[model samples]
Target: MNKRLLKLAVTSALTVAFAVPAFANPFSDVPAKHWAYDAVNKLAQAGVVTGYEDGTFKGDKTVSRYEMASIVAAAMQKDLNSDQKETVDQLSKEFATELNSMGIKVEAIDKKVDNMVKISGDARVRYGASDSYDNTDFRARVSFDGKINDNLKFNARLTSDNMNYDDEFATKTGIKLDTANVSFDALGLTNTVGRQDLVLGNGFLHDSAMTGIASEIGNLKLFAGHLKDSNEVYGAEYGMKLGAADITADYVKYDTATNDVDVYGANVGIKLTNSVTALGEFYNVDQGNTDANAAAYGLKFNKLGLTALYRDVEDGANSAYSGMHNDIQTLKDEDGYKGLEVRYDRALAKNTTLNLKYQDFEKQDGTEIDGGARTQAAINVKF
Candidate 1:
């Protein structure tokens, strides 16, 4: 076909595919009286076409396969009806080779859609009993993640926990915002600010949510935040890999009214075999006049989905924000505790899991506290 005929054919196809009114003309060469003016204007507004750098449509000139492929690729990114999508799909196949040579895949273009926000959540039913107490509860969490741009993201979670089955549905529990934060990259560091989750040194020293800012680069992270108790905390953690072992070191300081408390921790995991790993961690806390320490050693049987650990924590060693406070509730005491814990985890199906845990603890003085032995079973599901 001649150049004019070919250009007319292309313009007609785009006009039929995107039948929208044009607000303004972007190409100087296409006057309002021109035959293809509306079609060219609509294509420009939809990002389906960009004329030459000189700002002229030059519709009399023939369009190359590469140029047509670029237009098809851009159309694939738009929200279209069934008929429009089918038209674009046919065009994509016709120009697949040109699109691929230009570093764009027709299949990838077809999959492109506006998926800026995602919603996910998990629910759990748990039962636990100890020497002094037994209870059953349910917990649910919903999370929202939004991509604002290539460099910025926002995340939030709503959670309700410890809902008694016997209570009225509406009165069982109240939902609360557990986390809200935005993360971005700047100045060679990835930074997160707001209420966010934080874990340090294999969770031996701290594991909880904090309100403030955290920055990370490479294998090092720096954070300054406050716990639920309103005490400000500052910390840094560095991790490195050496041969078959991974090591992490961290330091945290709590800024309180009475005094500044410091904590130091080191954690290591060594691969012992294909299905077994050895883990160790040590933590020391300094509270001015008093000093305390905690240590743990464990073995992880990866293939069997089991873990066994022994932990010793002095009366003042454990952090109030430790995640263990929730997992091993019987061990929470001002007098400190030492314990042996065993856990078995297995996936029953996709996005579903079963967990069984048992712990035995005694006070530092070798006396058993009430509810010192505890066991729990939980089923968790995620979507």
Candidate 2:
């Protein structure tokens, strides 16, 4: 046989044998006694070649350069001998443009493609109701992320919200710049600057972005930023991974005239079983003469995407510590309040999710005074 014919037969057999399904030999046209049968069978076992849907491999037919390039692409990841590698390299070069267009890595242009930037965003619609009132809202966000080089990266996000859509003209709408940050790694530490998402200790206490600098040191993270009208603020957070359990702790402080105080919190999450997890968290903050504390315990069902939690507040649940100020009373009428919450989330489709949540606590400012219970449902879509 001519060299081209022989090469085509060997390459086709290799691809067919390595890539095809395991139920049986895919090609009825290729017989067991054929010279290339052993090669084709071996390739099939390696899952390198998948024959035509009709279960046929025309062994005597020649393959085009594109077909050979595709076959060589599959074999590129295989443990090939020096001669086989040489043959694959030659074939790949002959079809470099086609291979690249098909998203196969042609090493020559891989670095060029790596320099591209990416953008992504999400939109959400939410409806919430209680015995006192009902409301609906819409939110949209867009983000851009880019790598400046091996050592630096940039990220930014813009968010818009429309609140309480009683009527088109009565609805409240606003736009905000959510995040604009740059991150880099240097001097044995990872650092980020500008406005970035910040969370501490299971996010039971704090989960909002601030304008500041954040640095990572081993298992500890330190951040300092100014938020709202507050003076300089700083915090240190640490986390430890222990087998099936993760423990996290944080200490944050806000600098103000008479309200200067420290907030400390800790949380632990344990994997109870393959599909069940248990979590507990505690937070405390002392503002001037009053000290407040919040604690919560919850169990999460991973398989069902459900969580049931109970949270309690003592002494003071005022805005001095809790970020959910609108949900808590300004002054305690009696001790504090306790609430039970159940949340469920699931994927409705690709890049879309449904969230349902309900909670009932003491009558705060937002919920009805008759009985402080609230139910909310939201759908989020990403692009």
What is the Cα root-mean-square deviation between model 1 and the actual structure?
A: 20.9
Q: Using Cα atoms with residue i matched to residue i, what is each candidate's TM-score against the true structure?
A: 0.70, 0.66
Clash list (residue pairs), candidate 1: none
Question: CA lDDT, every prediction?
Answer: 0.73, 0.66
Worst 10 residues of 2 by lDDT: 325-334
- Stretches off by above 4 angstroms in model 1 are 1-111, 166-169, 328-330
lDDT (10s digit) by residue, model 2, range 201-308: 756677666899999988999999987556667999998878877899988898886568778889998978645789898888787787888888999875566899
How many residue pairs collide in each prediction?
A: 0, 11
| TM-score of candidate 2 versus the correct structure, residues matched by position | 0.66
Model 1 gets an lDDT of: 0.73
Per-residue lDDT of 64-107 in model 1, one digit per residue for the tens?
A: 56656655665565545344566677777877888778655565
The candidate that achieves the highest TM-score relative to the unseen native structure: 1
Worst ten in a row by lDDT for model 1: 18-27
